[model samples]
Target chain A: MKQWYRDTGLQARMFLTMFLLAAVYLAFISFLATTGVGTMGIVVVAGIFIFIQYFYSDKLVLWSMGGKIVSESEEPELHTIISRLCQIADLPKPRIAVVENNVPNAFATGRSKKNAVVAVTTGLMHQLNHGELEAVIAHELSHVKNRDMLVITIASFISTIAFFLARNLMFFGMMGRGRRDSGGIMAVWIVSILVWLVSFLLIRALSRYREFSADRGSAAITGQPAQLASALMKISGTMKRVPTDDLRKVEGMNAFFIIPAVSGSSLMKLFSTHPQIEQRIAKLEEMQQKMEF
Target chain B: MGFLDAFLGKTKLPKSKTKDIFAISTANVTFEVNLNLRALNKAGICFKPQASSHFTQARAEVEELLAYSCKDTNTGYQITKDAYGYTWIVLEDPDFEDLVSNIYLVSEGLIERDFGEQLLCALFTFKEKGGANVYWIYNFKHGNFYPFAPKANKERNSAFEFRLRSVMEKELPIEKDVERWYPLWDVPV
Candidate 1:
């Protein structure tokens, strides 16, 4: 399992993906900065928003999911498992909360691990056995340990701002341009739209890679990659039969879903928030076999 | 902190000398003030390896020793297996000192019988941080003691674990090998 962490090939790929994302972000920001489209002002406002969200993301996510922060008294077994996993992962225990929803899912949220929160639905508690539950929780803890929340949050922030700029360029251009230099304003809008589209795809690709990283993290922490692989299989199976009505209401929260809400479409694989479960399971199996050696 | 750290061979040896159980007694006060945990008067013996004829005789002999030695201590003992197949001999008493003494005596007896290899851990139970549930985990393999401070919703207060380590290091032979701190998880009661 530890060997997986030291895999230079995997690390090189991860670093390369990160480098590409950085390049894209820098190019977008430079374009906006050079064009004098109030990008600096937008960047300042977005920075403040991201800062606030980063600090309060765990609490906000828990609240948004209708989760209640539980004390050790409220859930001894759950606390025990998380604490043990945290010890193995060499992380401080993140805050634990439980969502009232009956969908079997779990997620980790926070800007950093110290402030992270690991929340699981009541349905998940009823679905998995102790070992399997530990595997799932360990997986979420892996996300926390790898600082995936911070990466994903930052990635999404740039894309989100790009999206806002693209959609509201005409409004901003009108406010700043006053019917003069219409060609310049048109070019600005086109640039913003292009930035938005490109950043959106890059953000999703980065997200997918982070998921793979978290899977590896989970396998390492738990020392039982097979348990997590099985858990993922079970989760994906349960996800399919889950009532879409309840899930649809929470569709906007798909970015934080444990198994991203699956929409039945051939195109879903291309746009889904998470990698296909089969691929994730296969990766875990590969690591499991490596550990056996 | 790296993957290599996880694969290193675990070193096991018989505890060189039996420490007086009086050390664990001090934790009652330390736990309350520092960790906000109440000592649950439940000390459990954890042994690894599946049950076999030799193990059964060793366990019985250890139990006999404890019953005879603790007759005046008023510590009640019971041997049971948790869901994970780890064997535990639980000793309950209102007096924390008596509980500690009983645990030490039993551990010493098992070691004397050459069954020390099967002795995995001895756990001193504590209530969860915000509630009245208990967690007692003793690592016999490491010969070092640590606390399992569970939170209300099933999380551990690792900061508290570190604090406990700092405070209790001088008082007990704490496990120096970090890997040996394998958590004794999911013990009933």
Candidate 2:
């Protein structure tokens, strides 16, 4: 089990992805500094906003999905299964919730271990069997155990700031021109756009790697890799059958889905939030073989 | 505690039989004092299934021993399977001491027969607070005992559980690790 954590190549990929994101952020900062558009006030404001989001992310995500916390009575089977898995994994039981959406998906979110919440869509409950559901819950628990939410939040903080700066660059640039140099303002605008583009790609890469790592972690916890592999296949197949209008509504939240909701176009794969389902299943099969030996 | 310690890479030792036996005594007292509920004169043995023919024969022998040993004491025995497929052998006696002794006899018989790995848990039931159901669960996996106070709505009453734990800590060999106190959630009456 320990080897599972140590051997996760996805972890290395995530680290590299974050490193690249940091490089982009630093380059943007340098451009702002050289062009005299680097304002202490703006940095302080962005930092505060990031900090708030970091702390409130779990609650925010759940609220956005219209999720409700379900006690043991409301979801006895789910509660029992989650508690049993927590027993085997030897971790504190996280809060369990259910979202009323028709989309079959689940995600774990929290600022810390104790405060974590795992929410599954109603569609997921209808779609998966007991074993497959256990696989999904175990996968989410892996994310909680690994502190993935904190890592992702920190890594994405800069990208969020770059997005904000880029969007409001015209106003900020005018302010900077009066206080400092117009040339510096232009450099800051240009740099912020570059930062937004590069960080966007890097964050997506990091998100994909984390999904793979979480999948491996789930397999180890349940000692059944095939369960999750099958669950992924089922979810991906169902995702394709959903109407395009409904899919478009949730396109922004695609990263939180169990299977990345995509039309299976090769072009779409280049910017997808998760690795291809076949690739993920192949990795799980590899792990299953390793476990047998 | 054993389960948590194992996960955290602590010492590995077989669960103490003494601790498993002792958890029942206080709940037995609580039944009489607080709720006017009689000790249903019963104890249960829970185990997993084994595929080997030898193990099957051994289980049959243990059941036979339990049947013969408790007949004279007016105690009854029954075996049932839970939803999760765990097998349970229940023995009943009005005398708490006889009930414990009978459980010990059955457990020892299984251990001697080399079916120890199948002994997953032992459960002692009690009725307190005017026939409210409560249980003391001894997990063989952890070799520890924890209180389980089930509410009417199927949720655990932590306050009642805490009170039971505090009052009976000395009488029962309580499990100290919080993680090992797994709630059985549902138990057959």
Candidate 3:
């Protein structure tokens, strides 16, 4: 049997981070319950926020990037490769999308695999060969298989609530008065800030691990890690040649892009959705080497 | 998705699996008894070729040795590369049992030569009421058999394939993962 390489260390750290995040959320909920901000109010508001993100963020992301869903006839080759990858991944075929841009990159985002979408830019089709393109598609499909979108959404929920709490306490003042009056607000503020700070790094670290795991998933589905490595090289190599004007076109949605590109969301945020190109390529190469044994 | 499994990103559900492809040979009787499917007595092993000189030499040796061993029998083999770059070593013989043995011998030769990882899959074709091709692919990596019957360009006869699996499931170690049933379009068998 094909024995896939697993990064137990990375997996353990990810689990620990999630465990700690859960703990922090538990304490935050308890704080909310006692501090008398009407936990119901916060829950309703958070629920609405998450509900919108869960259901509609995909459309918003697609629209913002100027992507349109293509029929199978228009891109049969793409559909064929994706269908094969799905079978190998045991994933239901997700909706396929194509953005009319010159960027040689792709990403997968949706609430789940059944309703998921894998979009590749026009340039990516031109840039990669069949094997390389298959690798990218496999990577995106792996994200769907691993449910990275949902994990990131949940992680986003935790941070959004923390940010919301901290901001409300800072600007609009505390809701219900607790036993300690001003002291309760201060305590909530400290907790929110701590959660926010920790989650910023923690979430970014998780994002990086998700990228690595997705790379591994791609290897598993395609059975060719080197194809992904070469695809990364070709994309990154051409990423430099694609011109700044074109890069700025998709800059608004760079956070969700596969490469975690330039000109948006501070070049060095402690958190990013995609891993570095060098590191991703290296990971795929390592996977390729390990699969030999 | 338990709280911990979801946290650890265990959402990628593992599909069904198998390892002993010899089960395919053993399971052929069920196909004939139940589904009216007959072995075509033509089988092939599809593999991605390594770029090494040793691999090239080993492939040539396999071809030569098979030709020598089956000189008296009608066993014949040919190596053809598909458009997608995978090499198919096709074997043919009227005796169904001989085809399986010949396939096994060639596969073992490749594995003994340390080209095991390069071996992708072995396939044995089956026929329904008429002369329509139904291929059962044995994945070398997973060591399981899955049915693949491509209709047109990349379209699969999945409904019929599921029926084929039902017939063979009891006797063969069928691949549980529906995802692993990769189609070999326009296969020359």
Candidate 4:
């Protein structure tokens, strides 16, 4: 049973990242209290926004992708693949939606396992053969199984709050009345910015870690990591050839996609919601090797 | 899934509970005595047949086993591919117990061969006094039973299904989440 899914290094990094995020969040909140910043209004506003976004995230994602939920009759092959994977993964069947795009990507969204929706682009179906497509769909199902939507939403909550505080503090710092007051406001503003920056990077790192974990899940479910690796390679290879206009249209959903629409540059890599395709494929290949042995 | 497990994306494949299907065999007595529902002498195991050669080999082994076992019980079985791309192993026998055990045998056979996850659900057909079809679907993964009474025009008789649930909830492991009571439209049983 303990064949290949365990990754001690990955787990350690994920735990450390989460621990650092929590520490940053706590320090920021305490700093706000010490400065008497009156965060009740901000907390309430952010709470309401995140709540709605979390609750309706599946619908929001589907709408943004222009995905239409397809019935079994419409896409029996897709449904069959998803249902079979769901059975293997011990997950309830999630609603399957199809987007009429030539982007060759897929994503899973929902607040919880029961409410999840998995959407794949038309191009993915047209491009991948049976095993490759099943591998990709299994990867999306892993996101649903791991509850990536809920985890990412909760992790980003503090980043959002810190961002809001930083922006509002910036305006207040500019309009200060006295030197001493301005100095105090300046210190708080810097702390908020620092908190925001740290949380944002941590969140990105956490998202990348979740991606690796989901890949492992796909490996576990399908028992074929090499297929998923091949699928990822094909999608990434196809992504480069897709029109820039098409990539730009779906770029906003990079975090949820099987492969981000854009890649390159170390600076962009640091902020990327998904790990680089080469790195992901490498890990999957390693898993495949372990399973084979 | 635990909090830490979810955080780590660790999951175990759920074990198939083909054994729990025996509950339906005993519950048939209650159905006949009180609900005026009679077993249609037909039950089938619907599964998504894999395209791989190994699955074909496993299924062939299951067929060979079924053929060998049915010879002794006088139970008749047929394998038919449905329009919806699912393979149904339909079993017929005057003895309802034989029908139940045969369905169980086929599922167990596949499971033992490591193709158990491909078995979708086991469906047993029953009829009401007026010739209306009522169905009991046993989800292999979940190990729960759900009533599916299909009406004409692609509709379900939820009221009647609910009554069946309420009545048999004590004797059978009925699936509580109605959302998971997926309808098997045009089931070839």
Return the top candidate by TM-score. Answer: 4
State the iRMSD of every prediction, in order shown. 10.3, 8.4, 5.9, 4.2
Worst 10 residues of 3 chain A by lDDT: A170-179
- Which ten-residue region of model 1 chain B has the weakest summed lDDT? B4-13
Error of 3 at A90 (Å): 4.1
lDDT of 4 by residue, A186-287 (tens): 777688788889899999999999999888887766766777887887887854544456777778976675645455898888898999998998898888
DockQ head-to-head 1 vs 3, winner: 3
Best by lDDT: 4
Residue-by-residue lDDT tens digits, candidate 1, A1-293: 22443445555565676677678778877776677455555656767888888889887888789988887678867876786556434567778999987788999998876788999999888877766687789778877766777667766777777766667767776887688766766776787677777766666666776677677766655546777777887776853544466777878976765655555675666566788887888888887666544
lDDT of each: 0.68, 0.71, 0.73, 0.83
Local accuracy of candidate 3 as per-residue lDDT tens digits, A1-293: 23444667778988887777778777777777787443355556877988897899679779888889998779877876676456444567788999988879898888877788899999999988988888788888877877788888887686778877776774444445444457666777788888888777778888888888878777666667788888887887834534456667877866764644444345564557678777788787776666554
Q: State residue B111's C-alpha deviation in candidate 4, in Å.
A: 5.3
> TM-score of every model?
0.63, 0.68, 0.72, 0.78
- Best to worst by TM-score, what's the order? 4, 3, 2, 1
lDDT of 2 by residue, A1-293 (tens): 12432343555566677677778778767666665465656667888998988789788999999889998778988887787666545557888999998878999998877899999999999998877888899889877776777777777787777777777766876765675566666666677777877787787777777677778777755656778987997887843544466777888987765654445787666578889888888888776665544
lDDT of 3 at B45: 79
